[model samples]
Target chain A: MGEHETPADEPPTDEARAEAPVQHGCPVTDSRGQTVLHPTREQYVDVVKALADEGYGMCVDLVGVDYLLHPNRPVADGVTPERFEVVVNLLDIYNRRRIRLRVQVPEHDAVLPTLFDVHPGTEAMEREVFDMFGLSFDAHPDLTRILMPEDWDGHPLRKDYEVGAIPVQFKGAPS
Target chain B: MTVSDPLVRPGYVATGEGGQEMRPRSEVTSAELLREVGAVLRLSEADAAALADSDPDVVGEIDPDLDDQTMIINMGPQHPSTHGVLRLMLELQGETVLRCKPIIGYLHTGMEKTGETLTYMQGGTNVTRMDYASPLNNELVFSMATEKLLGIDGDIPERAQWMRMLLSEMNRMSSHLLFMATNGMDLGAVSMMIYGWREREEVLRFFQKVTGLRMNHNFVRPGGLAADLPPGWRDDVLRILEMLPPRLEEYDTLMTGQPIWRERLQGVGVITPAEALALGATGPILRSTGVEWDLRRGEPYLHYEDVEFDIVVGSYGDAFDRYAIRLAEIRESMRIVHQILDKMPSGDYRIQDKKITPPPRARIDESMEALIHHFKIFTEGFKVPEGEVYVAIESPRGEIGCYLASDGSAVPYRMHIRAPSFVNVQCLPHMMRGGLVADAVAVISSIDPVLGEVDR
Candidate 1:
């Protein structure tokens, strides 16, 4: 749905209709309170749009998380489902403030919508996430290994990723 | 004539176990050192250094000698330009650096990804090790982001804020002192290396006194400090305040007035304001280019709005300007430090919010809930109500920012750092593009990159 159209039948929030994204819901309190969690995919989109309207035009970085051993979402419950989360770090040089969008997605077939259409900086950070955590950004411009070589298997940074297993070498580390 | 003829006729000495030469050795220029090294390594004869104009590591388009064309010179992984194990491929003709490509990640530690597994409080411990030199700045910025996310930024105590400001300026001074020391070494001022490091050691002593650790002091938490300043922190800091200025003046006289230092720095590694901005430069590099945009001034967090200090700027934006601006900043930082010490207010140092800061250690033994709270906080860590926030502070190098994502859990959802050295590094090639290859060292020194920040 276009920004203004709002799904044709649903009424938009009061501030959305006002167009003053900067004054975003004075002391911006949602029914969700201070900590907006689990963001139910649609809530994620609304938050991003509202923030964009608030002047954070740049999504500076994005990284994924694996809650393989989270105490709250303990793995004793058989493979922590929906334990994966993505953090989108946004910056607005114009406004001089920043925000972090924590969007959660499940571990199995973990994927999230790519905001590459809006920010270019996400390109590098997302590819890095894909390389390390195997989480996919649906439409990232160019998803490929950045720091690691093409033949290298397993992201070195992942919690489950093995280290010292791959005796590393560089431009020319001879056997 | 044979190249060994010069070696035979004069007091030309070879390096050895001849009792490791005393440093601040009024040795030859690094170029001359490299030429001698090339001879020692048997890679080239002594005359080959004089005959050759470009780095031997490159060939064809990579070498200027191949076509009388632009040559690519690899400046690091060993060269002095990169402060640590960083490499830059420079395209050069004669002494002019044409196209410089900085190849980093030689020291990548995976700190950000490592941070994901750590709890919110432990996260500061992990991130603080990145810059190594300015540990408080890293922790302070990261803690601020968590505070904003948890909606408790204002709950931090007044004394904690002032202490953070105090230690932060001290960190800035020592960090800039290191820069001065190293920049002088890069410029062939032998004594400056000694002078700068000597001053830095004293600052480290102060850091150890207050935070209990020399480099990685996870002392600045979101709501307050890691621990209150140690007893006598006041007296020790006062001593440092007394010691630094005269030494700085000593450096000013020893090398700042020397024609060789001026010649090496004045017109070298010139970064214009437009290019610095285009590349997202920060700290000394950006200020040298005349931006006058410091987060301390622009946003003014931690009662900075109340403090009176000047944002030092330089006119030329070259290696000299980068040096002079930082030197001036150190003096200004000292001024701020003195003010923080004199004006500090007495109160509880940590935040009162029970959810963030645990009850007193004494109370932990008496109250079961307090004991459990302290244990849980120290062991598993606290939750941050699923949300995200970014907090940036002006580090010695530039803008050191932390973007934190919390999922109302024990550990962070994701943490990404916007390191100043990483951004400031982009302008290296631009600054070096039209400069002589010889001046490349001057430019690199001016940027004062710490690969710990870059590779992290």
Candidate 2:
């Protein structure tokens, strides 16, 4: 089956309707016919939960991107772009449909509620975002570093962070 | 007689408060060592009392509920069975594991951060190193994502698509062969190691002939392949396909029907479907749960829909089920490869679009505009339009996805590798919980996580 399957038969939840300002309850198409949802940070978990109930049970991937340098990033009409964006890809296995959710978290207050309670598989992914982008997840069980050392000084993935270089050493070549 | 014995000299030895021997230093290389030892020995009564009274902070806070009798053991940042530098801290109650925590980052190279500095053309080189075992999958996902962002996906030539599927299936075979070798070694079937590598060497020789490297082949690129397949590539693939079936049957005789192998793997490391979904396990781990979700068949990218093969599934999610699925998948991959060889298309290996790929070498020498286009494409890479895309493929490990965001620049704004091994490793704790410590190696090998991807 192709990705252009009919939407789930379940009625839209009230929480999903409330997210109309950020994203219409109807799914929007991207290049590949993936339904892209731009939910506000407040409605992030609610939208994910609502979709999970509708058989988009598998969380394919959760990714965090720093749009620090990309100020002109496109967004829905009513929503403002943020410094950091968390992108989630969910799949409905039985239906063979893919959905993409993009949520914006501002620079000053870069916090989004945890999706771990809904998708327990997101535990490590959430920790990775906290490690790389310094974005916190509220009510996350353990928000420690996953990819970097625990004592690592700064978020390495931020646009402002320098990509520092360590000089290569050769024996008896130089001090 | 004991006190006066010449062998037990008085000043040569000291006894601890608990009557343990404190041997005197015999060969002091430097005065500094001698002085430190003398100072330690000559501590005055007050100084010694002060030393005894001091309490060290090294014994930090422990979980209050952790029983004092619980034995915490570290498996590896350097153990043979971990496949890499993966370290697992296990809290054990006798022989049974109570809790397991995987502490990674020992192999972290920060490839994602480094990807931002490289241009879009150079992105494949960085991602191919993430999942080194199945490098083409990484390259394919990154290239597809880049193509999607550039809106040039439709322009890719047909020959290149078939070539990609062919090479990827070969890569899948090689990766699974490595798994078979390592899994056997981990499970104490030492002879299977030799047999597995013998078969894998045949496959790698073909890879070396095609890509000029055994592993980390950055051959798959944004628009298409690095170059067209070498002469007689089809015959080479057909020969391998003809030889693999009997070798796979040899494995059946060697391990599949063996009662000991079944006893070690069956009913061990059971991950329920609910737990598997909750933990986001994919690839064989999810397939073993009877999900029937193979991205190649389900998502249908890279002309996989044109091929005919079954999505191998297992009745029970256990180590044996995972093993059976992988073995079955090798057969399925062989079937796909056979079809690809027959239906191989004859056309340009890469897209003819000047914006995405440079003009041919023959055209470059003949025409000035072609030369200039080549120079521009190589020196200043083509800029991708402002957008984001997440493209995934059924890698040997799992759904290896690449999330790329471009900002109308030659270099990507952000690149995130949704590494399958990274997510799959999280389920290790759940699998190992309450299982015997001896079975941990079996479970870890069954997951077959490549540390390059896990700690990327």
User: Which is the leading candidate under lDDT?
Assistant: 2
- How many backbone clashes does every candidate have? 4, 0
- Could you tell me which 10 consecutive residues in candidate 2 chain A have the lowest summed lDDT? A1-10
Give candidates' CA RMSD values in order. Answer: 11.8, 12.4
In model 2, what are the clashing residue pairs, if there are any?
A: none
Q: Candidate 1: where are CA atoms >4 Å away?
A: A1-146, A149-151, A156-175, B1-68, B364-371
**Please, what are the lDDT tens digits per residue for candidate 2 over residues B359-387?**
88899879999999988887789999887
Worst 10 residues of 2 chain B by lDDT: B15-24
lDDT of 1 by residue, A2-69 (tens): 33323212222555433432222211212122222234444555656566665665454465766555
- Which candidate number maximizes DockQ? 2
Segments of candidate 2 deviating more than 4 angstroms: A1-32, A166-175, B1-66
Fraction of true contacts kept, per model?
0.08, 0.55
- The docking quality of candidate 2, as DockQ, is 0.26
